[model samples]
Target: MDFDLTILGSASATPMLGRHHTAQVLAVGRKQYLIDCGESTQERLIEQKIRFSRTDCIFISHLHGDHFFGLFGLLGTLHLQGRTEPLRLFGPAGLDEVLTTQLRCSGTPLSFDVQFTCVDTTQHQQVYEDAAVTVNTLPMRHRIPCCGYLFREKPGRRRLVKDLLPTGLVPEQLQALTRGEDLRDDVGHVWLRHLDVTEPPPAPRSYAYCSDTVFTESLADLVRGVDLLYHESTFLHEMLERAVQTGHSTARQAGQLARLAGAKQLLIGHFSSRYRDLEPLLEEARREFADTNLALEGLTVGL
Candidate 1:
């Protein structure tokens, strides 16, 4: 029942001290998703003590170098380590060609199979779904084709309260009760009623990831009432002009999005190198959204 977000890097375009680039690891149960594998993410993963073996799926926001430059090396290392499990990667168009070129030039033969899927930033569509979770893409306001991700956990099956069950019920009978299935004796009779034993599944919990993008009001509904939101605050309010010029958002802008979307909490990052201190940015965002928090490396959040 533990979900966490570990920041691998937090700098935009240019690298800086104490900050690497844009990378995040979202841990949901035994699954780990690497989001935006910027340069140095592998090292950061090792440094942060995140288990690389547990990572099988990765989501990339766009084709920017700062957003996914670390993919090649990380994939190469996973191969060198003799990994046999399949790894799935989701990103924008042309990403497959780019990585394929790199792999060809580097001659890095992988032991595990790698699957790549391109995300259509312009479409509001579900990209991946399984029994455990569903991953969807949100159209974003960026200079290039970019998208955000929304992870929604699937509802759990009805779990029977074991202690409340009638005594001496067979284990198979208990499973049938949990599945809302009726049982029959050798003489042919109803053993369990769906209404008497099972309850509805719990509501799903969700997390939304918004990468480098402007604060566009159109996205408010797509991420409305999300449990947690990771938004890019590349500049402060004073740098509104720069933010507009660069397709970035100010701290206040990020806060406004969080507020309008009705998100429970906001984690802000993807800071510009010009800013040395982040306290002012945090202050500016916190002023508008009290649940706002700075996104730092190794900081984990329960989704």
Candidate 2:
């Protein structure tokens, strides 16, 4: 299965030269889940050739305009395009009201059902789950009630050892063996030993996202040991005090968080518009975590 993250936009507060806002898509297997819908998200999706029908779920980290202002536009486009599948939206309080008001004022009811789940930004809990993965909320310290998201892929079934299995084994028995379940014949004689017939499943993969929040050491444990981590770095280390006051993180602080969490790789984005060249910010983050990478628009990272 293809597990990767594609960046649509990676700017902070406002769009600039080559950067838009904060938007990303997490593709797992054949499905795609949008993380945030910043400005021109629909255009970005079209530009990237991502089908609107594939995104069944959307996770908004916060109410900040830079993080989710483009959500309504995308939904409207989807409605116009004749999408009938239900969409599951997870976000902080008042999101439903915002979207509803816009739709109501425009007198355009959606063709699809929208299921909204209000998230409690103060708690850590599993908010959504499917056969392939589970999503949890990550509490964050910010100007408002905001939270991040953690995506964990489910463990797969054990692999079968076909060479050792007898040729006459039925499909049902073979399925049991592959699932690591012991199989027996009608007389209760052991037909297959699960351990001997199959190898253990691969470990689950995980990804964490943190955006528009102040730097906090406690977050290290919340996103510990993830395969990939995408965190916001809206300013340079020189503006640490300003970053704290604005409820934002500096590049160096983002790197520190990844290092403390022991993440395999760190992705830094949400750059302040003040920066024309982000080389300094990248250098600052790499000083603390060598595996750090920049979150540029259209960049895709495999997990």
Candidate 3:
């Protein structure tokens, strides 16, 4: 039930002031999955007290330097730290070549193996899966081939109420009830109903990530009804023309997408360096969608 997202950096295009770039950590239970290893992500992880060894999977949205510039450095640091566990990486095609070329030129071989999966930016497909969650790619319209990620938790088994259990029922019978199945007694009579003995499982929660994309209505269907959504708002409404030209979104546009997608909550970030104050962006988004928040560094949102 430990589902939350922690932001590491939230700047866009260039690093300025105290802001670095784009990176976040999604923690589901004890496992941690990294999303977009922007510059200084390794340091941020250490600063946040997140164990790098616990991170088994990484998802990179695109080949943009601000999105993945820290990956090679993190890999080399893991090598130096003597990490032995293999890491699975999902990213757009050519990422493998980029990383391999960097490693080869530097003559630094990692101690652990990096299993890479090239993602198709044009398709909405299942990219990664485990016992806890499933990740799907969300096709995005960006200046380059880019995509977002949808993280959906798996449904858990029903919870049994001990006081409601029948005395004669054994562990097997209880387990069956937990799985929403009815149990029969020796005489083939209905001994216990699943609904009578157990409570329904907790609803699965989801988080969607969208960044560096133009304002596109089709994105609404891709991330529909997520518990929480993180979308890039690199500019304000006054600069809508610039947003379109650069393949980025304005704060109002980000909120519009969240509203259209029926998201429970919207977290907006990737602010342009020109703005010293971010309240305008937040206010603009809130005007369109009341449940909106700024994606600041070190902020954690629980779902």
Screening candidate 1 with a backbone cut-off below 3 angstroms (N, C-alpha, C), the clashing residue pairs are none
RMSD of each: 2.1, 1.2, 1.2
Q: What's model 3's overall lDDT? A: 0.93
Consecutive 10-residue window with the lowest summed lDDT within model 3: 165-174
In terms of lDDT, which candidate is strongest?
A: 3
TM-score to native of every candidate shown: 0.93, 0.97, 0.97
Question: Ranking by TM-score, best first?
Answer: 3, 2, 1
What is model 1's C-alpha RMSD?
2.1
Evaluate all candidate structures by whole-model CA lDDT and list the values in order. 0.88, 0.91, 0.93
Instruction: Write down the worst ten-residue block by lDDT for model 2.
Output: 161-170
Tens digits of per-residue lDDT for model 3 on 256-282? 999999999999999999988999999
Kindly list the per-residue Cα lDDT of model 2 for residues 138-211, writing each as its tens digit.
Answer: 99898998999999999988888778766787788778887778987799987679898788877788999998
lDDT tens readout by residue for model 1, 1-303 = 667788888789998988989999988888888889999899998999888988889999998899999999898889888999999999999999998888788777788888999889998799998767899999888899999999988877677765556778888887777677767778989766645766766667888999988888878799999999889999999999988888889999889999999999999999998888999999999987999998988888876
lDDT of 1: 0.88
Between candidates 2 and 3, name the one with more favorable lDDT.
3
